[model samples]
Target: MIMDIIKQGGRARTTGRPRDACPYPADSRERRAWFEGYDGSAWELSTRVPHPSVALRGVSACPDAATVSNQAAAAT
Candidate 1:
């Protein structure tokens, strides 16, 4: 997996390694940097080619009922 490290007040860095690479060893610079600006909510993962199963699931799921109800109310 390609890892992108973004630190506050610093340029983003990209690190390429095998998907199974160890995240960090104890007492490593990477570990320290990760801890300094780790914001779980700001992180996201995306792919250009999604799996077939995921696409199928998304298509099959129902749309938000509340949104449909709100639109109906507005129309009336």
Candidate 2:
């Protein structure tokens, strides 16, 4: 976990503020990607992509079956 945070350029000193809870996603989605960015004060969702090239970090969980089912149903 520490390694992952470091790889994400988690600079403690620059951050100034103490680290809060890690918002690691508990689910993974196929052909979908989520990103975060800091906007001066705090982190926020940056963007979403249908397919992302980079290997996403802090995503330790796989998407649940029900989520995929619902997405597919909605698409149809």
Candidate 3:
């Protein structure tokens, strides 16, 4: 399986390696960052992508969610 390089700490998932194979020392901020990245990437692997039609409904955010929603609300 091709490994996906994770974003936060620029780490990659090596084939046959456990998801918890973080190089950073445990109980450290770096480890926490890696763990957070693992959490997100793992979740991404499991969840289905948002429907393409969502963007047509203005669910595609620009800048940030709150700002876009506020702008949309104001426009209505």
Candidate 4:
């Protein structure tokens, strides 16, 4: 398997080995500036992309059960 080189500080996913080669999220809200793992892990294997701002906005706009449930599901 190909190794994923994650930034120790910033949360960007890059294809190349160079640290600065990752493409950042275009949306300001989705953009992350830092990431941390205690055990000196190289990468976080994930299948989903983060959409925190959307989830936050959704929850804020409608704190109802249905929207919150949907957001929770999406996050997972």
- Please report the candidate that would top lDDT against the real structure: 3
lDDT of each: 0.41, 0.36, 0.52, 0.38
Q: How well is each residue in 1-76 modelled by candidate 3, as lDDT tens digits?
A: 0223244433433233466677778776666556545444333345533334455676744448878789999999
Where's the lowest-lDDT run of ten residues in candidate 4?
30-39
Q: Tens-digit lDDT track for model 1 on 1-76?
A: 1134324312212243332343556676555444333322122243123334455676533358767988999999
* Model 2 agreement with the true structure over 18-64: per-residue lDDT tens digits: 43423444443210111122112222234332222132553423458
lDDT of 4 by residue, 1-76 (tens): 0123223323332222344433445433212322221122323444333345445554453458777899999999
lDDT for model 1 comes to 0.41
Best by TM-score: 3
Give model 2's TM-score versus the native structure.
0.18
- Looking at model 2, the pairs that clash are 28-63
Q: Determine the backbone clash count of candidate 3.
A: 0
| TM-score of model 3 vs. true structure | 0.34
Model 3 lDDT on a 0 to 1 scale: 0.52
| Per-residue error (Å), model 4, residue 12 | 6.7
Q: What is the C-alpha RMSD of each candidate to the true structure, in Å?
A: 10.5, 14.1, 10.0, 13.0
Worst 10 residues of 3 by lDDT: 1-10
